[model samples]
Target: MKIYKILNNNAVVVKEHDEEKIVMGSGIAFQKKKNDIINRQKVEKIFVMNEGNEKFQELLKTLPEEHIQIAEDIITYAEGYLQVPLSNHIHISLTDHLSFAIERHQQGFQINNKLLTEIKALYKKEFEIGKWAVQYVAEKLKVQLPVDEAGHIALHIHTAKLGSGDIASTLQQTTIISEMIEIIHQELGMDLDEESISYQRLLTHLRFALTRIESNEPFQVMDPDMLEIIQTKYAKAYTIAVKVADYLEKEYDIQLPSSEMGYISLHIQRLIT
Candidate 1:
């Protein structure tokens, strides 16, 4: 592909099939001008723009080559580990976060993540990946990143996985899920078996419930006979579900309709049994 624009000595914008793509490698654009044919052997990474190229071009201008390269490596590793395709925008977000994180660390300013505990509990796999990324960044940059930064990185990964790109909302959902799990533990007087199918089912149910709550969507009302039967059959679980609803109402100002309560009670019952 011929270079359409040069981002730097190591990076260039190329057009293929009438689409713009950012290509990068060591000295890929050295002494190259627009319309020059690119040497494919030197290219290490290619970023296909999903929204617009302007933001990426801006990022390339300000971020160092090492930071960008590290971000790309982390994203690639995360995709392989998670076995899911991350949103293309992760390249932009991760690079920007790393750049800021490095600057803050250099200037002796450390940022704390208030949701660190919740992030670790709710997003176990992603948080583990984030910790690995932190170590990777530290070794590569020769600067130690604070543990809290792992939580921040996990949030970015979670947001990308959700494809929502809303960090605040993703964090809220995590906090909610964590709180629910805590309630379950407290009410059941035992730790959950994380590897069990029941726990996975409950976790999935809670995730979707949080999504609906965030969207202000109420669950469909259940038939009175069925609701009564569920409430009576799973009395303890129903009570726990009520406690969860109370927590949601008090903490998030979200009301759990009776319809939602019935399904949540079922999931809780499955966990206990």
Candidate 2:
């Protein structure tokens, strides 16, 4: 595609099928001008400038070329390591975050990550990638970012992996899951073994349940007889599930249907028993 505008030596805005796209590569635009044809083989990343993503375009234009390169490199590594195609919005979100984070670090600002422990426990793979990302930035940019920054970066990666592009919703989901586990511990009066299989199962169930709740998707209808049997068999577990559900509703204004609660109760039963 021909260059519509040059972002830097490594990136340029190009038009294809009448849609604007930001294409990046090593020296892709060196000695090039507008209307120059891009070398397809040299192109490493292509971001479609879709509607409602004007900020992405502006960021591409305004952020330092090196910062954008770092974001692209991290995104490439994350996608390969996680084996998931992250939402393209990560290009905008991560680039913006990295630029701001580097600036903050340079200016003697320390942003504390309150959810560091929870993030490490809940998002193991993403957190691993986040750790790698901070190290990568350090080696390239000569900056010593705090470990808490990895937690913050992991949340961004998790949001992109969900393909939601809503970091607030992802953060809320993480907080809810962490708190829900605490509710189970309090209501059932047992300390959970975070490394145990049952605990992992419980965590996975909570994650999917929140996804369904947020998407307004109903859980599969449990038969009334089976539901009643399980509730009766695991009365305490079911009660804790309801309490967790209530917490979600009251604290975040997120309503969890009874069917989802029933599913959560089964997971809770596994943990308690």
Q: Pick the TM-score winner.
A: 2
lDDT of 1 at 118: 63
Question: What ranges in model 1 sit over 4 Å off?
Answer: 162-165, 178-205, 212-243, 250-253, 259-273
In candidate 2, which residue ranges exceed 4 Å CA deviation? 16-18, 35-41, 52-54, 162-165, 185-191, 220-239, 253-273
Q: lDDT of all predictions, in order shown? A: 0.85, 0.85
Give the RMSD in angstroms, all C-alphas superposed, for model 2: 3.4
Q: By TM-score, how accurate is candidate 1?
A: 0.75
* Clashing residue pairs found in predicted model 1: none
RMSD of each: 4.1, 3.4
Query: Candidate 2's error at 261, in angstroms?
Result: 4.6
Cα lDDT tens digits, model 2, 48-150, are 7576357886786788888888888999999999999998788888999989998999999987887776788778888998899999999999998888989
What's the residue-level lDDT of 122 in candidate 2?
A: 75
* Full-model lDDT, candidate 2: 0.85
